[model samples]
Target chain A: MSVENLAISFGSNQVLKSVNLELHAGETLGVIGPNGAGKTVMLNIMTGILKPDGGRLVFLGRDILKEGVVERVRMGLGRTFQIPRSFRNMTAYENSLVGAVFGSGLTERAAGARARDILDMIGLSGKKLEPAGKLGLLDRKRLEIGVALATGPRALLLDEAAGGLTESEVAEILGIVRKVKESGVGVIWIEHVLQTMLHGTDRVMLLAEGRDVICGRPRDVMSSREVEEAYLGAGVGARTRRKRA
Target chain B: MGARTSGIRQIGGAPGPRGGWAARKPLVLAAAVVVLALLPLYASDYGISVGILIFLYMSLGQMWNLLAGYSGLVSLGQQAFVGIGGYTLAMVTQAYHMSIALSFFIAAGVSLAFALVISFPIFKMSGVYFTVGTWIVSEALLVFFRNWAFVKYDAGYNITVAYRISMPALYLGALAVGLGATALVYFILRSRMGLALMAIRDDESAAEARGVRLYRTKLACFLISSVYTGITGVVLYLNITYVKPGAAFGIDWTVCMVFIVVIGGLGTIEGPVIGAVIYVILRQYTYNFPGISMIMLGVAAVAIIMLAPEGIMGAVHGRFGFRLFSTERRPPPGTGPRQYPEDAADV
Candidate 1:
């Protein structure tokens, strides 16, 4: 998947300006940025939830901007929201089954098998019958990923999948991402958790003011001067401080 | 796991803790239908009249439940279809000189077409706007019919044939329509579209992102619901043999539907059945009160909404963990807990 020259504005407030990125098969790409940096906005545009002012989103060489949300899912582009949006009234098993049945367009029998497999893989096997609204935050986050995976996507865009998790829980999430990688599915993960961006991802892209400031190995991007200025304001950067003195 | 999946072809195949009742539901349903079919023989004329009203309200409540509970389209103008249904039967049978049997189909088609037409505008609005949009559409139609010479300029058309049909035949027709509407909802919910509707109801953006076609699924639901509401209208007007614009397009019809669904259960299949029965009984009992009855019913509805927001069936399901008409697929034995939380049982 590749995005080129993506731009969108909400009135006078330009959310994204000419952003671009690419994802290869079997790779995990982490997107890190400060608040209002358009990370989620970009993901929403990619998933066809929001239309960009100008951009070319090519998935497997097919421009997907014209397609709607469901068509994009069927075309193997799946996403999970930052906030857990599981069908609260449905059981965890049934929730996953929805994605398998509709997202993958699998026959009912095949979808049932796939849903079972997804529930087992996500470690929700014990609480398969539990209503999603009743699940704990950790379990809900896991189920979010499980539901997205049930779509049978070639590339999955996760918006803050581990937004509110303990250290160990984040590791468990990362472990699931490893399994996703092993299955040869590319992932574009956005996270505020630095540890997840540093360790779980193959590469990290630091976004600020709706543009990619730097893209490289996780440590390199984290240590870059641009990232510090982006996060802490330009006055806090070493070079800016020296010039001020 | 294999055993559970093997029965996937059945609607409620997975064996839950309440397996005995769940498994025997079909047989019980058949027996109940047999009893209802035999009601005319032993019951008085008034009893049969009440029965017919219960069925009509049942059909209307189920259709409304399908639109609001399942698909998240909270319509306040289902009377538009009801009125259309009633008026179509009148116009087709009396004005057009069409056969009564053919009028039933025409009424359904007309309402279905109306649903399709209004969908283009109403579908654009969501949440409260969608609800108000529906009410406005029905009101507009009401005004249009009132002035239109074709519909006798608001005086309404009377179906003379309604007198020709016996009470038994009318009761049978009402029974068929009631069961048919319930069966339609049951089958839809048991199919893949059922999942989509519930998913949409839970969260539209998430459902759409997960590959559920939002508009198409909603349109299908609206059309099905409208057609059934129209057909029920035919039976409804047949009972009265008199149809006026005020009576046919009255907000009271929509009020009855809302009251029935709310009193019984909002989303569950069994909710409407219980609600319709309760509503008919309550209406019959309150008939003597005349002036105070509307206020009394309002108080009752408020009490139910406050005490049990999920309604009677919801409270019952929460306590009993069983459904007479199950549309859910539970986990296999030992895979999960025997009993789920209230929400899981809601399906």
Candidate 2:
């Protein structure tokens, strides 16, 4: 139900230091921070892609400090990368099939059925047979989402889902996440695109220099002085600081 | 429509176009072997030799497919094991005077064991480093075998029995082994073990996170691959009635296997078959042309990589919804998007 004092250290650098955060059963938490503020690191730690040095990580009221990425996924937790990770040799459809069989626990035929349906839903049905290596940015992003969705997570963590999208494309993806939330799945999205986060999420969690600077309503948190001086300062820079703050 | 399309997902389960490939593959395989069994009875001497060579490479290529293609290890020195297998068979059968079949089995066993022992050190290296380490290992093996001289490094063979260009018995034996190897690859890919292999290929860390005990999977793949390649070496030496360190441990074999699997379809079941058939035909006809064969093969590899990186299996998958032989499925709609689920439905 919540993260309890999760901390992670990569080599000498302690990326996350005793970070405690949570989301309600039906809420979206937007994570925003400076580039190296450990936003993606925090997501990796949560998904068990990276191990924590100290502190506890709980998923659905169970300790997940030691579970691996796929185990965490099987425990109803899933995530997508900032840069989409797909099997280059497989088709868009086949890539999702991997998620279905391994991540979603579907039988062979059932997995194909589900993968086809997911591709269709993501507007990748026509491109499903195309090699994943040949896909453009938008379709690759969609494929990333489709693969993650195939795992069927109760709580999905997205890392920069709209990184390279046009504004309209961003809005389209924002709608997809919103629809996902409607299916009773909890979402925590990290994005540098502030407006998309502000307009899309029900709540917001701002990470700064490996720590949570602000957590609450998106607009309120975005407008907070600590966030402005640290996160938005990094985003909007010192020149526009006064007006934005 | 997603729901309706989901119903059609059952199409692959039926034996519609591709034959009863899934269920009766064993029987079909047996029949093919029987056909091969009768080949020497009617075939000309040259035809038998060509057929035997095809069987040998098919075995080598399938094993190479497991190591280089599915596991993404991409070793360029697998010929070292081929040398080891041939020499071991030759020595044991010659000096020790063991049975021919026993010599082949022992060689396979030794190579499999040896490969398992070294996999850990080799795999510890990063992508290209792993490949380089294997190459060095093979080269070192070649040097050692050549210098030992007790195994007749220069002159090659000391077969007590005079043999034809090719024998019916050896061809039949090679045919059986080749069929077994392809079938073995098919079974491994279709099983949970193959899943672990693919997981390692696609994303190593992700597979580890999912409790895919990497050491065991990697060891199994290496050992199985070594055994097949090793057996081929035995067959190769026996057919020629000679075994030399240089010829037995030649890099050409490994290179050819890689070329075949790469062009056929790197990760698909049928890729190696297509690749092997094409490569064998080219090799059979191109010996007198010298380096031209290598140049053409190299050009073909570059073209395949630049144009069709996924190879023919991927092309088939892209053009039609045909897996041909892959057991992997596309995660269907309503199954949710991720591969693993807390519950079965993933809903």
Q: What residue pairs are clashing in model 1?
A: none
Residue B231 miss distance in model 2 (angstroms): 2.1
Worst 10 residues of 2 chain B by lDDT: B336-345
Best by DockQ: 1
- Per-prediction count of colliding residue pairs? 0, 29
The superposed Cα distance between candidate 2 and the true structure at residue B152, in angstroms, equals 7.4
lDDT value, residue A223 of candidate 2: 73
C-alpha lDDT of all candidate models, in order: 0.88, 0.76
Evaluate residue A242 in candidate 2 and report its C-alpha lDDT on the 0 to 100 scale.
Answer: 57
Model 1, runs deviating above 4 Å = A239-245, B1-17, B330-347
lDDT of candidate 2 over B19-41, digit per residue (tens): 56666766876786787789998
Give each model a TM-score.
0.92, 0.78
In candidate 2, what are the lDDT values of residues A1-245, reduced to their tens digit?
Answer: 57776777777888887677886655788988877888888887888767777777777888887876667877777678888877765678777766666776666576677667767667788888787889998888888887777767778888889998999999878877876776777889999887778898998887877778789888998877677668546556555765655
What DockQ does candidate 1 score? 0.39
Chain B vs. true chain B: TM-score for each candidate? 0.90, 0.83
